[model samples]
Target: MILEYSNGLHVGGDSVKAEEIPNSKDRKYYILARLVDGEHLSYQRLSNDYFISRSSIAHDVELIKALLAKDNVSLGFDNSGTFISGGEIVKQKVIKRIVTDLLRAADDRSSILKLFIDSSSITRVEEIFQKQVQSWQLEVPEYYIDDIVISTAIVVDRGLLGHHIADAKGNQLGSLLFQFDKYPLVYELIKGVEEAGVYSFTPDELRYLSYIVIGNGFKFFMKDLQIPASFKSKVKLLISTVSDGLNIDLTQDTRLHADLTVHLYQMFLRLQAGTTVINPLLDEIQENYPQLYGTVWYAFSDFGSDNHIAISDDEVGFLTIHFQAAVERTKSAKRVLFVCPNGIGTSSLVSAKIHRILPEVSLIEVVSQVDLVRQDLSDVALIISTVQLPAQTVPVANISPMITTHDMKTIMNRYIDVSMDGSEQEVDFSHIHSIPFLAKDHVLFCNAKSRTAIIDSLMAMNEWPNAEQRNMFRQTVFQRDTVQSTYLDNGFVISHGDPSLVSHSCIGVAILDKSIDWMSNRADVVALLMIKKEDRKSVEPFMNVIMNGINNKDWFISRMMEISEHD
Candidate 1:
């Protein structure tokens, strides 16, 4: 069952061979495990054990110390050397992190656990945990299941070592997470572990274990999930922060607010316990949705700092997925009004063609030319017509009566252009972001060596109401850059400050003589966007322009560079 849960977690790791000398990552995990397992380790002792020098071992220990400090866990020194000393809960957090790292590097989780825990103990715990989750018949996400398995094993390993929580009295309210009699999963698992001669858990320990389950995202399963009013407010603040930064009103997005409130609350529990669930699509999400990812990261940073909780990039990435969905939701579409002027037989043919080709159009209303004049077109997104319709307010796709192959392709392209799923839509390569951008006077070539120089050069070209406002805009740009570099994979950085700080909505472009290293990659061209609150187009379609422009680089760069000297 454990193997079933651990079948295919591919978190970018090479298979770690035991015969090979441990790499820095592997060595760090081993050393951290030893310290957490009550082994007093010193530089010289570690040096002798790994046949490495004392200096190297000291470097590793120093790095390990910094990592533990971030989690509020301390590396303590005594007459017996050095070991990690923190509350039992925090220690388990460290243990879970270590286990998570090891899991990333190996396919066989049980083999990895056997290094620190007895094989028999791991097997018994895996069986009990699997049985309980199965009994609940819950469809838990695989990434979540992986997280719980690590945490559950950690509880058994650490609890039996006599390092149990002294008193879970403070968490008495939280112990209600698992009503042992009603929800026998946690209760039965603990009992089974002790019966299998693994470890005897105290009442406090039992309560702590319930938290372990909850921390690993068991709260998502609780049918009577009650979110505190205070947490809901924080969730709203988070949404508002991102909304303010983007200049888009998401407050009215009741579904977004509801979904995000739940997600952040679960994330809050995970962060408070120093537990993190790996998001497998993190790389793809951050890459494809860089702006959304950066905005969410900045918002979450504030949310965590305000609430005194630490947020991980993984958590930020997860929340970004929710917001991305929310942003797409804002691109609301109405029913597609299919207009057919031909006979009923032809109208039926057109309807069948659309249903077969454009499966994305959920609702299709076929209207004759007579009905088109009288029908309320307010709710229609698109009009697929067999004949020309004059003075149409909605986008009209006038196609051949037969709806040829070319017609299907053209209509699909048009549908994609006006759709929310426009990221995958084809963009015209020759089309420059000239309209509304007003970059002719601002776009200029530069010999800048650094990103700051590029930003400074571009900033000087823009009109600011005052020095204070200029500094405020600059600060926001840098603040966003800190969260995630605006560097695109195509050697271009689309930099933008907060929209509200802009006195006049404008954009500036800089093409450098040489490519300098931007945070993620190298960049030669940088675009600074200063959008005022009223300018809802936060460099929209332009982002798509930059992304799709990657294939036609020479033409795109030459075109953008030429914009500098445009009249």
Candidate 2:
């Protein structure tokens, strides 16, 4: 074994020399860890253990004390020994810091398990947990089970080490656990730990274990936990804000409100405990559904400010799942276009009859056969035409010149259960380009070498009416990125600003000189599609066209190559 330093000083020996002792930072960390684990190490004791002088240990103690003081913790020495002093809240913060380092050190699943569980005892705990899960028939998401297992193992490990939580909060949690202690699955979990016989648990310790179970989305906790009304009210208010902002009605969904309220309640509890929740589906959700992620973030970004509890992206991702499910629950209005062959009178009559028959159908517009062929009916759900027309992608309802009851009934039956199945079709980008939002002038050929530089150059265009608008747009774009990356996998980023900041929506094309690690993805970012706020959802179809083009290898290469050459 050898000791080495950054300065290339190496001593080849079995034991480290006095001069090769650990640095101040390392010594402080060791002392802090010992104190966190409830070890009362006096200056004399530390000096004797580390083969260091009392003076050296005393200096290290002062350094550690200064560090602890910054976080409102204190180091004290008495006749008993040296100890770290702080309220439970501050102590929990320090514990969280230690746990974070340990988790980081455990780079693999096996290593993580070994950190808090005996290798021989792991199989026993696994079998007990698995059996209980099977017996309860609870559909716990697979990703969350790891949290439950790890948390339970830590409780058992700490109990054996005599690190028991006996605070008021712990007592309350324990009493709550006792309410359902008779439940078979809960009993099984407690019995498994008790049967190990290596450690004894206080009621408070048991409650701490139960808290872990609940925090990880256990069904047992939901049945027994009583959420405060105030928290519920805050969640409901947030839902309302989200509903209004997205223009999606969510209040009528009682189930959604209840579910969101409960989830937020548990999230707050976890935050207060300084515990981090991990979401396995975060990457997939962010990539595949960027719009949903953005909307959920917009809705909840203010939640922390109003509630005094910070919410992380992991928690936001979990909330996004709830909102996505809720959005699926709301019935979307069906858009229908009526095509009539004859004059306005006949089309009007047909429209009136169709509305009377199917009230759920929202008639988009009345178009003649010739007019309908020229119109972009991409948004149309169903087209009811009195005249025979050419074959098209959208489902058509062909009826007689005089709309009859049988024809109406036939049309209703054929498309009643119809839903937009997200089938891709050819899109025309002519109108999108024609929109005043983007033009040859709006397109910039920047020599910028980074994402931020390219974005700044694009927003600096005269297209932004004023400096205030430009700054506002800049903030909005970066804020969105902070929530989730706007960079797509196809080597292009589509960034946008708040709708209220812009007079009209347009896409800005920025051909970067090179892509320099935009959101940790490397590529020559060929273009940046900047969208204005109001046009976010409205321009999605156009985006779909762009994405489809990018996904097609030939189109992506030729188009981007053409733009690159021109620049």
Candidate 3:
């Protein structure tokens, strides 16, 4: 006979009931939690607790050990039972993942607390956190409250179980984040945790709790004003360096300055707390925008050293995103010509509406259908008309008198692909950087004896799909070099190939351990601007950056030294 269970779970035996049923995933989580909590979980005890067969429990333990190994943790056996051995940070990550997965698997929020923490402890943390946020009159997002509470619960559970972040026996905490150290609200939150009387936090744990508070979408009103002076100055210096190196003045862009300052403040705090924010687009950015990535990486030389901290490529990728956006903001908007068969008033309305919808685009002119054919169409990047138009080189968008949401999306998607002027348009440096081509790993410092070895080394460093593609890329670069030297006068060469040779647009840079001769020019550094032939325009801005630097050799050499020194 078959049996049914509450909450839609099921079993095949008549004897099994809702309360008695067990989820194998839940049991695995329980086992992991026990190990993480420093409990001696033997096969016998786990089987008895879960009312599962000893064999089944043993299999689950082995599966968990395999999983732990993936996280750089080890599950070992002793005379007593099973024990877990790993650094505190690794343990914390595993524990958090276990709780999170359980929460998702159960499709219930309370499952995590029931499995790892008591109701009273959960209630105490929630109440104290709520009162503290309220007392401080801080505006934290409503959804973030649950995350804050969960993080607090994990801290309390781990702290009481002897996984202390202060003593941090097997783990190293991030360098002390000074920005939030002196905040009065942080002290209040600590006081609330102590008042609970169930557990106390060390200074580091308290700071971490504050990190939880800030990390979960809490935006302080004074965040902009609170930017550390030294941090701001360093960011300014870097931006200034890039501006001077590329001859593109970024300082005048107040919007970029303000936005970058705020991002750096939050990023610095996270770094200080040893929490590295993950950038999902790191790989794509590295492969596509190699030049921009290398340039930005050079920009922030004092990033980790000044704070006495080590920064990860993930952090550098995040910073690249901010600077990339800033560069795009400075570019001229793509010009689009609007047409209407109706009177000028209707055309004017369409123009105004399109402007509101696409603030990034410049509405060059409003022309009648006849005028569209008659007027100079050479300047137009796109043609938006109420009526159908004759054959045209530029993209023609046909829409109603009033542009709809669908119409707006159509224009945005097509505009990027269709350059207004038929022939390849002059590159918008700001626009090209919008989709990054370089990642941190693509740029490297190499010790090569000759130009050929350096080229070979770079080809090996870049992760191509196969050896065939690498050979083609290497041959293409060499063939091009033979035709005419790609070397610039100032100790550098810009090596590149047709788009078909490269899977994606990227720039790989190598600061040679020693100088090498290239035809007539002798150089120690080489930049390979590998791009898909279709994306040849992206090379223009980078070439301009190098040539601009070439104009001021001292400026270029100084920047190159910064890169070599960091290497």
Candidate 4:
């Protein structure tokens, strides 16, 4: 084996090098790790161990003090020597952070983990944890399980060394202690560790461990876990916000609902405990799925600020996977368009009949064959037709005007075919050339510095006949924006208001002179999409254009700006 340094590579054979001192940077980390592990420290004693002067130890302590100050932690000294001044939980957070920073990219984490426990001890803890998880059929994200194993190992190591996490203070997490019995995985894992007789735990210590269980994605069984109504409401709001923003339907996606409910609950508990898992695929998720990632990020702005925890990009990356999967699951979300050659009376009657029988389909469009050619079929998942006079790309279900039970079954089967079709659809660039509301006065520039300012500037440009309607439109859009922002990944925003409140469908575009903070992200371009209640389907063209702008930001925005400047 050989070791490489700035000077040169030194061919070497493994032997005792006890006299060789670790560099100052490595030495400081070792000292800090020992401090985090509840070790006694003093300049005199430290100098004895390192064979260094007391002033040299004092210099190291100053650097350590600066690092601790980042977390509002400080060092206190007395006649007995030096000690950490933060609470017990804070120390655990430091330990967990150290472990995370070490294990983020390491193939073998046992080296840094040895700061808390030996290699053999870590192995023992992992065996105990894995057995409990398998024996109890406990489901947890593998990322979180690794953190739990390290945390449990640290607890055992500290306990064996005559140091225990103090828990005599009134417990802030007592409410969760009861869940250990409800969630047997918690009890079984802790019991398994105890049975080994490696470390006995007190009542307070058990309570702390119980919290560790609940916070580390142990609430895997969603049906058995008791979720607060408020959390359920928030989840519903999240789905609705994303649905409205993307112009798609996900309200009936039970899989998305179930998975998000479980994931978010555990995420909240983990955040409250100050423990976080790193995502190795965060950059890839952010880059590949920019639109979905941005939607999820903006959707979580209020939720995070309200809870006072900045939702890290890694957490957002984890959540984007669930939403992206739901998107694929719902791609063939059938948008049945019932067309009849007859007038409005007959077409409406037949379409209403189809909807009445298939109550599961929330949206059904009633259109005449004459109007079918004018419709935007980019988002139409399936079409039900009474007249088939031409060949087209979209799959059509031919049925009589007086729809029967057999017709309903046929439509259902066709919907299944469309839903399961994995063939990809190309981006709809046909509508980008003729995007609506591109007049010079409509595509106005603004010098706003905030979300509220930009929204106000854009709203004032809308062609409202009266103040009452304008105020109503403004209030609805404002309230929805409060619930979930409409910012996109590439610094573009697509905010909309109640379509019924508008007399006509038109877009008000805002081009910011500079980027403004929009919720948790930034935005330099804003589009106010206002549609009439009857023109809901027409919004597809506008969405395609917005997506093109997000995906091809430089060219799209520059062209739009040039057109705006010349128009």
Question: Each prediction's TM-score against the native?
Answer: 0.57, 0.46, 0.51, 0.51
Provide the lDDT at 269 for model 3. 55
For all the candidates, what are their Cα RMSDs to the real structure?
10.1, 14.9, 15.0, 13.9
lDDT of 2 at 267: 73
Highest TM-score scorer: 1
- Superposed by TM-score, candidate 4 places the C-alpha of residue 244 at a distance from the truth, in angstroms, of 3.0
Greater TM-score among 2 and 4 belongs to 4
Instruction: Put down candidate 4 lDDT per residue, 1-567, tens digits, no spaces.
Output: 000221121212333234444456555656776677556687887766566789888878876764554333567777767877666666765666566556674576553456545546567888988887787686677877777777777677666765677853344446655565566666777778889876787666666666666666645532376778898888888787666656678888999998888778877766655545556677677656655665666556545644545455567788888888888876455577888887788887887887776687777888777778888888787789877747656888888777777887888788778765533345565445456555555676768887777777777766888999988988877666554445555788777766678996777778788876565455788988776745544555555556557767776667566656663
Question: Which residue pairs clash in candidate 2?
Answer: 499-533
lDDT minimum window of 10 residues, candidate 3? 1-10
lDDT for model 4, on a 0 to 1 scale? 0.67
Write the number of the candidate with greater TM-score, choosing between 1 and 2. Answer: 1
Model 3 TM-score, 2 decimals = 0.51
Question: After TM-score superposition, what is the CA distance of residue 493 in candidate 3 from its true location, in Å?
Answer: 21
For model 2, the run of ten residues with the poorest summed lDDT: 1-10
Predicted candidate 2 versus true structure: per-residue lDDT over 1-567, tens digit per residue? 001122222322245456645455466655565666555787777776566788988778766664443233566567857887754334544543344345545354333223233444445555677777778777776655665665555556555655556662543344555666444465556566677664466765565555656666645536655677887888888887667545687888899898888778777656544454666666666655555565565556556644555556667678878887888677556578888868889888888888888776665578777777687766677888877789977888889978777998967875674553422234554444343345556566556786677777766554667888778867876676554445444566666555567765666666555545554344454343455444444444434445554456356445444443443
Model 1 ranges with Cα > 4 A deviation: 1-25, 58-85, 106-113, 117-123, 161-163, 167-199, 216-221, 271-274, 334-360, 363-567
What is model 2's C-alpha RMSD? 14.9
Clashing pairs in model 4, backbone N/Cα/C closer than 3 A: none
